[model samples]
Target: MSLTRVLWFAGVIITLAMGIRHSFGLFLEPLSAGGGRETIAFAFAILNLLWGAAQPFAGAWADRAGARRVLVAGALAYAAGLWTLAVPGMPLLGSVMIGIGLAGTTYGVVFGVVGKLAPPHRRSQAMGLTAAAGSLGQFLLLPAGQWGIDHLGASPTLLVFAALTLLIVPLAWPLRVEGIERPSQPVGDAFREAMRHPGFLLLSASYFVCGFQVSFVGVHLPAFLADRGLSSSVGALSLALIGLANIVGTWLFGHMGARHDKSRLLSGIYACRALAIVLFVLLPVTPASAIAFSAAIGFLWLGTVPLTNGIIAGIFGVHYLSMLGGLVFFAHQLGSFFGIWLGGRVYDSTGSYDPVWWASVVLGVMAALLCLPIRERPLQRAEAGA
Candidate 1:
């Protein structure tokens, strides 16, 4: 019953954060001009960079202090960021604030709490439930964002999201698990240890492919479809299909993680992703092909999160899960930075996404090979008193 409540609250927080975040672009459009669209892009870039940059520190803080304090600050910052959307000359700054907020409110911290609270047997399931919750939010929010924007208008919608984000404050109280450090080692030392681990470095490096693949596909797929002479609706529906299918994908992989070796699973995901992308463009570009491809790709989407977080906890212990996971995620965000920018740059230069598509294939193969040799054994400190 206790775990149930904790998962429920954590789910709500993730759902709210993910759902409202997608809609931010809608409301921000009205605020652009004089390359304001580019301004928004730059702001989003800043947000992603800051979110990655801040995550490890946030994770470390959450590890040392209880999560409740960090969560409250994140909630407030999120609310304040939404409110900033209503202000003049504030969208960019709001992005910065929200970036900081996300470092606390997002997966590393929430899953760190979940990972700690879960018994060894059920840890993967807990992580799955959380990922499923966020996937559900993404599915629902796509249409909901359009409706809310049309009905509420930009300013009111921003205000509404601000109010909604505050709910995370109270919800955070139920999952305030404190950090557990090794009895003999300082928290900084745990991070230092990870910094030295080849497995940790490789794991972090592989996740960059994840961020790159997902962001590139998500951002450029619609445009790619258009270039192939497909209808815009085809592109839009394909994205929606990916979101809807992702819920099942995340849960399925999460379920699989408990019974199988997570490293092999991660490798399989990247390999399958590579195969799917190859088939997607190589096959036909019809609506049917598009939907099928989208669904296949979507099924692989976010399948990495639970398994990756589970592996990190399994290998390192959950004592510094958030901080360590945050560092890994920061690497993922940097990959995201390069993925989106490079995809656009290539398309503009070559008038084709094939080069980027081929790049995804190469990266996928690399990530697949990368995960195979990762040592999945728990860190030595895990067996000692913390």
Candidate 2:
């Protein structure tokens, strides 16, 4: 298949898969209203853990088998998870299954394939474009999810989402590669080697903050807005704007990664996130303020994905891209688990999200600091040097 076609297919898969995943947080309130916030939060927290846990295996499968198999299986799991989620009293089941589904369909698997397909010069741009599609999904689907809740309620809306995930089945076909690309080292050895590299460790550590902050907001922001006496539609619009801003942010960063030090770019993005969060919290929460905050954070949202992937590909090469990326993402999901779980726990104890917001701000600064030291070049290996 043509590279253009591959990118198109990969982009659509990301959009649909991420669209449903991003909007699932909308159901947190409706589901938890009965079970209490902790129950729902735990379920989401588990989902993040499972999503992270499953990623390395999913990526390895894609690397060893093919993207087609992993993606199709994910699409099926996604449909089942959504269907289960629609049924009342199945939050944990739905969360675990959907989290499992997302592992196969999301960044590691899709971008790994794209990394292999795109030429070296253009790979970052391809990943940026793909990440942008995921943001576009958030922008396009948040309102649709909000609309579904308004008209159909959460259960039926999830059933609608079950149908939506099925769309990924066809999209995965184009990503099927002829064979695994040759790696500089065996997959097993690469993971062991990368783990020892300071740059890789720093990259993973910073990504944890990314997962923590983004998942916290993605899952809880709607309810956060509701707590402030804003309409749910306002929350929906805010999410849409975040998604819209991500399109530009992701593309710009992708282009810049090609030309600049991606590590500095990452540091810049993280610093921007810290400043944005501080400004958001210090300022009063008005409808205008809320919308502006969404736009600001959304630009920084998911922009890290391509740059991180580009760095990994630069350091480790594409042969083991999926596996390495997934391992890095696992750290991200660990942070995600804490972020989602803590948001509710803190709220349940204090009746405020103030602490959580401040924690994220601090993490943003730490992430910025860590990102600066990442070596954005290929890993030095005796085998490759020979």
Candidate 3:
């Protein structure tokens, strides 16, 4: 009953967090009225970068202090950030706060609670369910966000979103699980241990690709579709399709992770992503094709989150899962920073997304290869005399 309640509330929190996040792309054109695209993109870049940088600390804090505290604080930060963002000339400050909020509210911290609540056998599925909830949010909110932009306009929509994020504070209460014990290992020791592990490093590097690929798509795909003369609705639909398909993909991968070798599954996912991007880019542009591409790419979207976090838990144990996961996620955010900033810079300079598209394909393939070599087995601490 406790686990079920935690998962339920966690899912709702993720749904709100991810849903609002996925809508940022929809605001680009509308927000463009106030400034150049790069300025907005740079703000998002800062958000991703800061989110990544803060994740380890947030995760560590959650590991020490409990997710409820971290999550409530994050929720407040997120709401405040959105309110700030709605103000003109405050994108940087707003993004910084939002980034910090994301570090606490999203998978890095949430998954730690899930990992602790679910047994080893069910961990992957629990994480998957949470991720799917996030996807569902994306599915539901993308179109809603577009509608808000079309009707209420960007600033008002941001304010509304800010108000909605406050819900996370209330939702976070159910996540407080009492009597769970922590391992004796110092947090610093765990960090050093993971940093020394080759598999952990490789996983972090590959996750960087995931961040780069998805962040670019999330922030830039709407504008890309517009460049192809498609309507904003089509762009909204494409993003929603990705979210819809991800519901299945994340769940399927999460189920598969329990029974299969997670590293291989990750490899296959990245490979599929590369292929999907290639097809999406090479095919002639149409609403149908765009939707098709969205489904294909979206199915592959966040599957990595469950599988990657699952691998971390499997190898290192859940005691430090949040912090370790945060370390890996930080690498992903770094990629997101480049992906978003570079896309805008390239577009502003060359007026094309081709370079970034090709870059994604290449990165995807590399990530696929990188995952092939990870050692997913838990560390033999006793054997190593640690």
Candidate 4:
């Protein structure tokens, strides 16, 4: 098969896996009721934590072996975890298992495959397409989950989603594996070299803010709308709109990253986010306005992924792309943990999400500023030689 066909196929499988995983937010209420709010929170935290922690290993395994083995095992684990979530009173274990499964299947393995297939010039666009597929999944699935909850109920909905994950196994079969040649530098040394790079640090830190904003809003936006006396459907629609908009956003950013200074583009995206959040808070909360805000913000959502991954690939080469990208994602997930957990804690304490909203705006601005001084050109010869 052609490279485009391979990418499109891989995109479908990765998007489905991630989309179903993210749609779990729709189950928070039911899961919380079954296991208690704290338990549910812990489960999600564990999920993100394990998912992040496992990426480096998964990436390395994929680099040394091939994504096929890791991805198939990951698909089984992901399906099993979703199935577990369907069982009553199994929230904690189910969530942790789901995280482990996600670690192997999602970003690391999928991107590793892309790194292998895509040429350097087209890498950013490939990442963009892949990320857009993930957003598409979010746009499509969250509402499906809501519908299932309202009409069919959460447990059955989850089971159905589990079945959907089985699709990953067959989809992964097309991945072409070229055998690994030994790295000129030791893997540990390469990792250390990446860690010490200024661009990598900036990319990782900026991604943290992206995670913070996206996770908080993704998890709480529906509830926030409900608290304002809007219908639950409004909240779901808002999220769906965001997911839809992200498709355009990611594609645009992917194209731009290929030609422009990626770091500056990242700064601009964050700056736009800060402005959007502030305006959203200031605006009236009408349904029309809510949908408008969701669409606008969604366009900016996940746009960072392509740029961030692109920078890593550009700076470091595809040989260790998955391992380094996984580390950056680890930072993103850590921020996600804080964003989701803190949003919940603050809501419980204050009965309002105003503080969290304000915090998001502030962090967004700070993140933009952080990206301003980032040097995006390839490393100096001396640095590269290291």
**Over 4 Å off in model 2, which ranges?**
384-386
Estimate, for each residue in 163-272, the C-alpha lDDT of model 3 and write its tens digit.
Answer: 99999988888787577787778888899999999999999999999999999999999999999999989999999999999999999999999999999999999999
Per-candidate TM equals 0.88, 0.97, 0.98, 0.94
- Model 3 stretches astray by more than 4 angstroms: 382-386
Q: What does the lDDT read for residue 28 in candidate 4?
A: 70
Candidate number that wins on lDDT, 1 or 2: 2
What ranges in model 4 sit over 4 Å off?
Answer: 34-38, 179-182, 379-386
How would you encode candidate 1's per-residue C-alpha lDDT over 109-222 as one tens digit per residue? 888788888887788888988987776776776566546656776667678778988989998988776344433557778878989998889899899999888877776676
CA-lDDT, candidates in order: 0.80, 0.90, 0.93, 0.82
Q: What is the TM-score of candidate 4?
A: 0.94
Q: Rank the candidates by lDDT, best first.
A: 3, 2, 4, 1
Candidate 3, TM-score vs. the true structure?
A: 0.98
Higher-lDDT candidate of 1 and 3:
3
Which is the leading candidate under lDDT? 3
lDDT of 4 by residue, 1-386 (tens): 56688788878886788788767667776676633344566677677777888888888888777788888888888888888888988877887778878888887778877866778788888888888998899889988989998998888998899889888888888875555454565679768988899878988898889988888888778777877888878988898888899999998999898888888899999889888888888998879888988998999998898888888878877777788888998888888888777777787778888898999898888889888777656554354465
lDDT of 2 by residue, 213-318 (tens): 9999998888898999998888788888889999999998998898889999999999999999999889988899999999999999988999999999999888
Better of 3 and 4 by lDDT: 3
The predicted structure with the larger lDDT, 2 or 4, is 2
In candidate 1, which residue ranges exceed 4 Å CA deviation?
22-39, 85-91, 149-159, 178-184, 223-236, 347-352, 381-386
